[model samples]
Target chain A: MSITGIEIRHLRYFVAVVEQRTFRAAALRLHVSQPPLTRQIQQLEDALGVKLLERSARGAEPTAAGKVFYQEARNLLTLAEQAAERTRLAGDGRLGRLDIGVFGSAVLGPIPRIVQRFRQTHPQVELVLHSLDRIGQIKALRERRLTVGFNRFFTEEPDLSWEVIQTERMVVVLPEAHPLAKRAVLSLAEISSEPLILYPRTPRPGFIDQMMRLFHQRHLTAHVSQEVDDLVTAMGLVASGFGLSLLTDSGRKLHVPGTIQVPLRKADAATVDLCVIWRRGDDSPLLAEFLQEARALRHPPPEDAEPVEKPAPRSAKRKRAPKRR
Target chain B: MSITGIEIRHLRYFVAVVEQRTFRAAALRLHVSQPPLTRQIQQLEDALGVKLLERSARGAEPTAAGKVFYQEARNLLTLAEQAAERTRLAGDGRLGRLDIGVFGSAVLGPIPRIVQRFRQTHPQVELVLHSLDRIGQIKALRERRLTVGFNRFFTEEPDLSWEVIQTERMVVVLPEAHPLAKRAVLSLAEISSEPLILYPRTPRPGFIDQMMRLFHQRHLTAHVSQEVDDLVTAMGLVASGFGLSLLTDSGRKLHVPGTIQVPLRKADAATVDLCVIWRRGDDSPLLAEFLQEARALRHPPPEDAEPVEKPAPRSAKRKRAPKRR
Candidate 1:
């Protein structure tokens, strides 16, 4: 049949008539006058070129054609209701999927626990958990794959949206009896002079660089020691008393027995928010539910945390990063 | 907010666009040209007062509003599809729930076996088996809560539609050593005036009525010793050598010790059909599937089964009283 003459409104009206029985009853149910219900039904009949209802003194009955049409009409209505539920979640940008692309880091910590709990509370939604470092997360979010996921919180991408789902404090893992462990929560200034373990530099400056920058800001001389890329291996070297390196509490579940974590006292230390990024217009019901669940678990909004930032706006670029597959 | 202003078709169209991504693509997919799809989208937008599309040269994208709309659109679509499926099932008279009013006697042999097979094949389709008599089955089908169930295949029913899913001639249940049990088959003519046992004429007409009608046609006389309301108890009496009586296959499954079933011949022998009854015009897809499955198992098309009798003209009237529930 020609689709040009059809409208969903007609099906809704038809469903109302069958459910309510009489045109008057359907009209009352629809909260409109009886004439409009009749009009819509007639319009539907004319459009479909079939008389759907056979009216009688007793009530209205569906013709054979009407019977067939009703099956399709009802299917269309159910989908509409689900879409409305998603829209209600979009106001705070805190709702919906956070497709976070993870990159290099291997060990998972308490952040995983937080995410798992969020899922339990909103089981209908799904989380597309992936690995990509900050650069990749930003790109995916711009393309609308993620509503929230890990990304560099410091990035100035305007069209992207982000809110901290959790904050992790930078801490040094060391042997309980080590020399640096005895100092207890040493300042960035004090820690700079010690030999340090480091991660790769190609993927933007690592956390060690951020610490060294703080050291330079304070005119402190930092000692260079063995550099390691892996966090566990770095922690292993610390466990061996080789050197101490920084880590975050986000993955406290990865705590090694021989190593102890002490809070850093650097000016830029203590904590950084793991900002969730999403395209501005990206709307997913499951994602919105996740954002709401995240907010509920984190207690105070991400704004009350140390991370001070607005979500990025919708970007002008299409992302074709061969990653869609 | 106003249900009258909306129809399920809009949501269906909206979900199609969101799922398919691109008005022209969705239009072509739906077998409609782009112009009508555009108009429907525009009208839906106007009604919802939300701009759902971000059309660019390469393709259209969901706007902030569109994403919100998509979520509800999908939900509505799911429910509507489910409802349509139900309607199709209901109309087929095979779709809705069937209480299947049946007498205890009917559940014994072929009937119970048939039902078990039906359940195993259609697990999700609920078929509530009720221990209903001939009267109960007719009443329940009329009330519309229950659909097809087993019953006595004695008479014709006009208000109800039924078929003899299975049929069997009268079989005499008797003590093993009884003289008649030694015979390959016994007819009313040979068993004339023998001590007979059967149900009384209360809720159901006595089996002797059908048997006697056969005897009258054969110009023979039969004798009765005791009367019981249920065939199970009567079979017990027969097994105990109190009397001999005839029953359908349903009464024979009990296989009471010392009793044996011998085929009995007569003009109007007792037979039963595990008949199914559903309201006319109850177009349920589930029911249709059920009937198709059942018909496939039973009829097997014969490579030619009467062109599958298309909704017979002047719906077959039940000549015998439609067994009332």
Candidate 2:
């Protein structure tokens, strides 16, 4: 006989006998016959190659080795029960880590609010945020490092799914002394010839590409002043009177001392969208709950929301749209 | 469905499917049919109320929740296997604690050797030694606080069993300058009128009682001097030339600077036996192994080893006995 020969039932029976202090009492507690209980304890001892209990005329008592086995068995049973309960909680998406990939100005506004709501609802889940751009987000998602990603201008992918969480019309950042800063709203065509500081020089097909596409669609060439790494660098250049910069409504939250933001003419301004992306068929409940929270805060679109590839038509449709809060 | 609806087999099946990445592959590995394997995974997902896998023409892949559950299930299965293996080891006496009650001079000699040998053989077993006297040993054994105890002059009780491990001849401790210390051996009658320091003032029916009984058996009155607490105090009194003290051979290991030990004449000396006591019918493998080690160091008796109550007859039998090493 080997360790494998001992079964979970054998442990239950032996523990019952030792606890109840009599085979007859154990059988009654287990709702089994006394002979069967005795035989099972015998089999357990045989499998272990050591006697676990000493039986007398009065009752039964565990030997020293039996006491040790009893504690181990009880712990194992408790762990087994806990495993099932934890697995169920995991399936419900309430007891695991959610790694989120975030980027740029999105972290300034909507993302923090959504994260706070998620924390309030699912307190047990750990939330990890990785600051990654659009291309990095997609790569991390495919590598299973990110459960979900939030960013702008995500191109369609066969293995990834994207959903528009919010839409913001473009805004232009100008130095406080610039002539355009006095206007309530400025048309992009009016400042197309002005020195413009575009951001995020690397990771092509990003926000810079979308900005260039907006200028090209209107038959205007942006006078490029300097190309920098991120939104903060571009805003800094604008603050120092180097050039004017363009941003989404979310970027307005960054209040530079010497810079002011002016809304763009809705007819000429392209609407930029913030969308969430994940693996195409990820059915994780955590992802579902997060998406639900995002949808709850979704901005009502002026027109049907479309991917960044078709930004020209969205601008044309926004000509008659009313201003939003 | 509730967590209780899930079984260990369901977890096993689900983990196999997730690891193999397909029902057919998992079935091949588990030696089961694909239909039943698919059904089991479905049942597991249903019980959890979560979609654990995404099935496509390529293969079945685990969802995010499925990944979490897979880890938990694997850990639970491993713990179950460990539980069985640990219980078997405990039963085999190779993986538990052996709490020993030790007192007085027994810690000096044979006890340490037996403990060292036990450690070499069973490295995983923990040995806890509690300094307890004869009465304390009996009480701790009854309370299940001690797996085994070692001391001298243990009275047989209904609930405790004892075996003589070693039979030690008595020795007289005196100041090195005393005339009796020059002799190789001295009889009890010669020292009957000498001031004798007795030890263990409390816990009567102990070593002091055994000493008084030995003198009584010889019809000699002991001229008791100072009564101290332990072996060290008695030896200290002997070294200071206050009074002579008697101890078993085991106590000879302690060498007080001005004191020397001389053997008691075998014909008049009462043989003190070091015996191990335990709860009757303990049958713990650890206890059994410890007893085996103790018995291996047993000193062959001059005649038959007897309990402390019958030490007089053993002394009579040892009159013609030769000296032991």
Candidate 3:
């Protein structure tokens, strides 16, 4: 009755005996000596308190019990083999699941395209998307709930790896009736005098830091206005003439009525990067596949281009912002 | 994609890694060095052509592929254990099937009772019943189609062993109007002078041989007026006053109208043994149980008897046919 006493070897031996229909034949098939095979069978019988085989001068045959055992043994062996195969596939990253952390704005950009491409290749993988802020994503990654995260800024963390995808030029959202709304471009000097609205005030030193750095470079102080926790609130305030707010072009996917997106003057323009972050050395195949797709979509290979062993990493330095007019 | 190289050890290692969430911890659990566990994982990955684990300073985690592998490996291991357990039970003869050979007339006596007792003790066993004559039963036993057979005549065979359960006393089946029908008992000397009928004329040297031997010993001869293929047909002829015939008491279970069974005189009575035959050394627990029940029924033990370490083997020799006047 104690299954602990039963071993894999017993199943193999029993199955061999049933298939060969004789102890001698089963022993030969299993590449073992007949006496040991016979002894093992006896041990099995003793353990189960039943007689599984009948040995006559003519040959050996399974008792009714033996036949049942033989079938179960075969099933177990097959399952074991299947487990090995499935494990290998999992290791290869061809099969499994991925839990990904996504910030709101990320869905409007490379994240969706990257996810789509990854799915096309790895349909078997289960992809779970959780909406979280940059800080929340980082915490979830450390806790192993989220395999990877896509956000608008990157911070240095030794325990985490960061890969920047694209740097988007900043634009201004203004009420359509505002005097500057008709202007094709507006310099930092002009906007510096205007009351400004900013969003996602918490998870600090993030988007605000980028804006502050831009004004600090020109020795101009940004006019303090109102700070909100979400882009929609910021846009709402702007449409009500609560001053203008800066957002990336990808945010254009969401249209707030009565608000107009305007390109900044070249000298005043600044850009923020969208990046991916994950726990450093996390080796889930799903994450790897997502990284590959994100990188490929952000920086596609040129047609008919010769292969390069390693592509040069993108520069972190911001490029000169192009003028709108 | 070639899983042939992936061994059970790899599955164990991979599962341990995922459970421990680190190769170092998995190695500790498996009692192997971390490097080998890591290498085996890599080998597993190579065989499956997938990445299964992400190893970092914090620990290791299954990639999506690794996750799938982990579940399958666990299943395989569980099945292997179950197989062993089932095999042990089969060896114990607690779980299996038995195909029994039966003759039409044998079912009227101890065979059905023996089968019922065996079933009550071994409910897990599957019992298959096949109706066969003595010759067919013997051939089926040799071909392994039957586990054991209940038959009337015992034939000598080195590959088969036989045990007599009961010897049925012979009785005369006579027509209601026959002179012997009114007698309490009749002698072979009296019956020898009257017309008689024998059944199943084929398979020479059968029950007729046994009947003839009894008559020859008495210095008498049977006047067989007709030969029929079956007992029913023989009974029909006897009902019409064609002749009288000898039958075992169990045949009385068949209610043949217009016939009467008359016990023979003590000096003239004959008996035939009903025996069980099986391939010698067949070690099915079902057969063992059946034999025990049958023997117990045939020879009920005295009340308050202590259990014997080994019940004496049944004597193979036929007993003297006791007088039954």
Candidate 4:
């Protein structure tokens, strides 16, 4: 019924039979006599309660159940090899896999730099990123399916610990030539009173409402001109003078040709914050190194910036910024 | 160069060498001799261009690459078994697998019922759900990683086609006992004046922003007290009297304890559109049946609500709905 009951030797024997086909031929191929191969197959059949192979006049054919067992056995072997390779890549604080879940916000500002640096430093880890919403990231983390997530407000996951890497004020997006573009700074009312573009509520509707309500409080509203769900599309619209939009400042780094950002005069001040989220219980050294890299990216801390200092762990990141000349 | 280059003889020889550890011992076990066993190993190695067994005086052992190749061989054998199992389960238009990607909305509706009914009717076909966002679903569908996705507006993908199954209008969310809730229906402006909870923009601000701006045209501004990226949290906020929220009648299906979804007077209408998206190029009969099952869950056609209908070709879904009653 389980792995504990199966012997690696059984797979060895099954593999033997599959290779040579004829019990006689397999015995010859193994340089072993036929009786042990027969015995091993019998033992395996008895253990599994399924006939793995049938000896036809032509040769041996795998029975239905036998085939399933073979793949499982093979996967186990592949895992074993991968484990060994991981061990070889271990001391450098890297695993053969780097299962990452990146929130859309993480791709903003210096995130691209962090990703590039991490990749160069740990070329051995097989990187897998799940572009996820905050909820999706939490669910996957709870399932032990995510190794790391770069996102906003770690959401107080029961066993997940978080570190704020950077923060930006949510900014109003407008076409550079839009009249409001020269306002220097604007409130929610000003933007809501203008043509607005936003995502409709199939999913990811929280930010749109947050921005709209900031205007609602001021007794103002936006004349929504377009409904677009893709962030890139919304940015394009804003750039193309379709309508203005709002998003975090780091996202400003993804600036399109004709768009500009103005800090909101009032609203959720930390909407643009990015945090590195990891399971609190995980103590993988590699995770620590990556976190350090995130910290280093905030170097020289911006004006009025409160560095999210957590005793700055040692970083093995490649060549930090060159010292002053 | 190919799988056919593989032979039964090599399998047997490999198994024997692994179990016996040395060609000499394997030869004894098989009652055949050592030289032929060595020849099989050599030929297998040559075909794969990798060393299989490393033999020195210490006896034979598998190299890491040898182990991985052995594992792959095992998977091929497993597929053969699954092929046979399919034959057994192939009747009644039920067999194989239906790999589906469920968008956020489907997770709330009759999807569970449809899936359960289908499973009950066809015990053989495996129904696998991959929870994905619109973009993720699109990527998976294009990559053939998912056979189907349930969502809104399956568009821009020439490789995918859509059949809208259900459409419902958006509703303004508020505490069940809020003054606005007492109104028969409120406009987007009425809701906008209150603190709103919303989804954060990932690629785009979720649809809430444009809906908010419709309020802006009326000089109504939304007071966003806090921002949340998930519907559950947004609903929770309304339930907790933290702020007002918005959702569709269908979106409100996940009723948080104190939340009420009321109609909007201005009808800043948001749509709860559910469509089934699949690769246009794939015409798997079972996919057609599953599509039928999906449509059936909303009680399809009914002579009035059929948006667009397409029938499955000759191939049956690994499982299908019960002949649509």
Candidate 5:
């Protein structure tokens, strides 16, 4: 037989003989008889065309080449074990990297808590966050660069699916010295006539469009004063008394020194949905774990009640309401 | 079955399915039936406690975890093959390390040629040279730190074996302007009364002892003049017109500016044997190859003669002669 005929069992036999220092001891350790062990080592030597061991009355000793082969064989066995362990960890979603697309005000609210909970549960999974607009998020997700994306509104696509994590009621930001700040809640009509600062100016069909649709639903025109790129810029304008600005509930976490956030009247307050989107058939364990953590945080169980009784909605797909935003 | 039960064949089967993208195609490639391939993949996933593939009308595609496992499995398979190839190479003595102990004037001659020839034949073997006397060589060999050692006048040891590679007739070194420089060959009786410089003041029972024994055998007395640590110092004294010194055949290569060397008369020339020593039972292929190269260079094949007619003596163990130095 040629060197190609040397199998894993041959290596096992040779290593045992060298480590145990005798064919009889190795056979005992392997739960086999001595004759076969001797035969296998002879076969291995013949196949490789070299004598690896010198057997004597004392014991068997590895020649120079056998010592080198022993080290390589040990490394191979260890690597084989590591391969299996890493694969199992990856299978359990306890290892590997997860790239997530995040945009706008989602970073200011529930997203951080969801990410924290996921990290605490699966610390080995690497979470890479990318800040992109809705259009950029969709493109990156389709390109497989992102495993999941979070945004205010997502248009339905044949190859993509979106799930609403939670709905946030619109809140108005007014200058601290303004009369509307004194009221606990205000109607959109009360503020519609006032000059408004909107965002973002680009990335069409985004948060700015959602805000415009809210005004259009009431058949009122927004008296635009300034347009900016992000919530921080619009908040800066509102603090300087440029105009009033609207934001989702999560935006309450951002506190500008000269501005106050007041809830809109419930009936007139338009709700914006924060949803996660991904390729429809993605079954990545890391994505599944992250989604589970997000939904659990969205609908936390009552403090005194059993968690099993309140089942989280697997997919809360809202009715397509005229393609709202 | 548990994850520990996953074997090489399971990995092979799963990788084939993923690469081929279907059970039927994978089976065709693996030369197995489709149903068994499908069942093996199911067993692999069950053992891992993770779903690895999503089968549909189009074909099978690996899930995220499956993708990670696929890469790791490929690496493991490649490593396994390398282990076999490396072991085979090592068995043929074409790979590994050979540590050699060397000392004194042997490095000036046959040792270098033997080392170069061995390196040419087994280029991958790492040759490490240690400057050690005969005692140190024996100690290092017992500790397994040395594969072979080369020196002159080895004393027999219970656990070590020595083989003579070649014998060199002694030569005398004198100042270039000395009257004796005119002779083609000299006798020990000619320089018996001249002041002589002896070398290797330390490491007793060494070359100095051997030189002293040679004088006693000829019934001559060496008039001692100076003692130095090494051959270079001894030769330096001789070049400076202080005294004379004797060296083996290889030492003729030393080009001291004011010194000239003349061979001793054939009857009066005491021959020194250059030999290699190692642990008595060491059957290392590296040592065997080195010894063979050294002997081949010593008795080169005659020109215009059949090389097969002369067989090299495997072991020329001379009778122990009163434990000579």
Candidate 6:
């Protein structure tokens, strides 16, 4: 027999008959004429191949088979209603999943703030953060792999809307024994003259490009000393007296031994903006809550209002300045 | 939102679109035109408040929200179909429960054999045996609490059909030390003069009535010495030299240490029938299997063909004779 032969209509009819205890009453309760109701019940019995009710002069009663069928039909209807309700919630973005495209360093900054605040407010929403490169995040967002993304690099994707959430000034990380280590704040030109190390040389047009653009805008070439693959490797190189590197305050918290992180004088010019990006026309309900939390974090209320605790990475090991060499 | 608004038809339409990957092809496959298909999907989206498909020059593709909805809808449909299939099986008596009403002593006779054989063939059937009295069995059968019953008592109930399976000769049970215990066979008149003991005095119209009817037919009065509730208690009474009793061979198997069972000479005239009863026109599929096994047991295969070992209750302790009292 075909499984789909029994549908919601059949279940409703069976439950009605059992509850009403008679076909005549069931028909009246269901607002249908007796002939059609009887025909429907007959069809349901035929579909199930079991005599659900034994008709008598007084009323009808469920047979052993009918009792079992009634219970299952009730269960099936309940599950169907629950499925519909949950699916509706999922579609409305009140329930279901949110895939956030994240960059490696983004996890240390606004990503944590946005995720923490979103989880607190919308605890029912499933949050999945996919660590990807800026290009990967952009492709995934377009391919519908991500609901939203947190990244620094911005490109002209007319189909997407990017809103900058936080901007941080750049800093110079130098080996303690370096000549410029004593400076509280150093100019970009003075640091550019020294042998400078940059990270993640591969995956072109990424953070490396952002660093290179800063030098190119000034019409000065950087003294390339070493090209390392990641922030940890760059920090290791600086600690071993290789060269100086440029990064943000979040990077300074790494605290590499024998290294001193000094703020750059041209902070306003050499800065990076962490932005939240999504498809231009995509008005996902959950994204609105995320954007709201992110905006609140970017601009906290006054001191008289509830305190906004600064989001810190649990792995932070910040040292203002190591013993001067 | 009203959950009932999202019916199975809506899920079918959504799945069709997702599978065909284009509204035009989906509508064609679904035997519906494109406009209606588009409208149906829009309505579904409106109900869910989420954009399931992203329209493009190539075709329609599922958004992140659409993908999740498609998966959930597919699952719900599959579950509903399975529920229907199982319910149908239950209605057809191919699956589901079978409650067999049994009497206490019935377990010692063809009941165990019938149950074991039925279970072997109908492994998928759930068998539950409820031990009740003769009246309890009849009442339960009428109320649909029992699918079938194993009983010997027959009443003039036009609504029930009773099929006698086995009839066995009655025998005499006596204290080992009694003078009549020496006889290989005894007549009703020989034991009628002795103090007779009856069992299961409670639950009217039971085995006691059968024994009483035998003596009444013989036009002889039994000299009852003691009345007991169960077979074990009766056996204990006989072992204490209280009186003699009438029982079948199956009952003889419950041999007490100080008692001896002897075949009565008028066994042919003093017999009882064991029958299986069910409501007339009550066709439960599992009952057919039970009847088949029971019939096979009644007329077992020849000794050389396959030895049908006689079923005996394990709790038996027999003594041929004891010191004459």
- Top DockQ model: 5
The alpha-carbon RMSD values of the candidates against the true structure, listed in the order shown, are: 10.8, 10.7, 11.3, 36.8, 8.6, 13.7
lDDT (C-alpha, whole model) for all candidates: 0.62, 0.79, 0.75, 0.65, 0.79, 0.75
Compared with the true structure, what per-residue lDDT tens digits does model 6 show for residues B180-272?
899999888888889888878878777788887788888987787877888888878888988888787677667779899999886437888
TM-score of each: 0.54, 0.73, 0.64, 0.34, 0.78, 0.70
Residue B194 displacement (Å), model 5: 6.2
Model 5, docking class: acceptable
For model 4, the superposed segments whose C-alpha errors exceed 4 Å read A1-325, B1-93, B203-206, B209-227, B264-270, B300-311, B315-325
lDDT by residue (tens digit), candidate 5, B1-325: 2234466677788889999998899999989999988878877776666667878898899876788888877776677666656655565556788899999666687889888888999888899999888888989999999988988868778888777777889899999988998899999888888888988887888777888788889899888788889899999999999999988888888879999999999998688888888778666656666766766876754344332112222221212235548
Q: Could you report the DockQ of all the candidates, in the order they appear?
A: 0.10, 0.23, 0.23, 0.01, 0.27, 0.13
Give a tens-digit lDDT track for model 4, residues B1-325: 2322445446556767777888899888867788888877777665544455667798988654445455544543344344334433342235557788876656676667777887887677788999887788888988888888876555455667877767667777889788877777876655666888776443242355654555566677777777666778788878888888777666667777777777765345545567788887454545766777777766446676643436443331233233546
What ordering of candidates by DockQ runs from best to worst?
Answer: 5, 3, 2, 6, 1, 4
What is the per-residue lDDT of model 3 for residues A1-325, given as tens digits with 9 covering 90 to 100?
A: 3443455577678889888888899899888899999888877666555556777787788766567767777887777566655555454454577888888667667688888878888786778899998889989999999888888887788888887777777888899888999988878777888888987787887787778788889998897598888888999999998898888877777779999988877666577787888878665545666676767865554455332112222122213235536
Residue ranges of candidate 1 with Cα displaced over 4 Å: A1-7, A28-56, A61-79, A88-94, A97-325, B1-42, B71-82, B108-110, B113-125, B135-168, B172-190, B200-204, B209-221, B232-236, B249-325
Lowest lDDT 10-mer window, candidate 3 chain A?
A: A307-316
Off by over 4 Å in 3: A1-80, A89-97, A120-124, A154-161, A170-247, A252-270, A280-297, A300-325, B1-78, B88-97, B120-125, B156-161, B171-247, B251-269, B279-297, B300-325
**Model 1 lDDT tens row, B16-130:** 7777778877887778788887778777765554456777787687865577677766766565555444443333333334455666665565556556666776564567877
Model 3 whole-model lDDT (C-alpha atoms): 0.75
Candidate 6, residues A302-323, lDDT tens digits: the string is 3453212222211111222334
Best by TM-score: 5
Docking class of 3: acceptable
Lowest summed lDDT across 10 adjacent residues in model 3 chain B is found at: B309-318
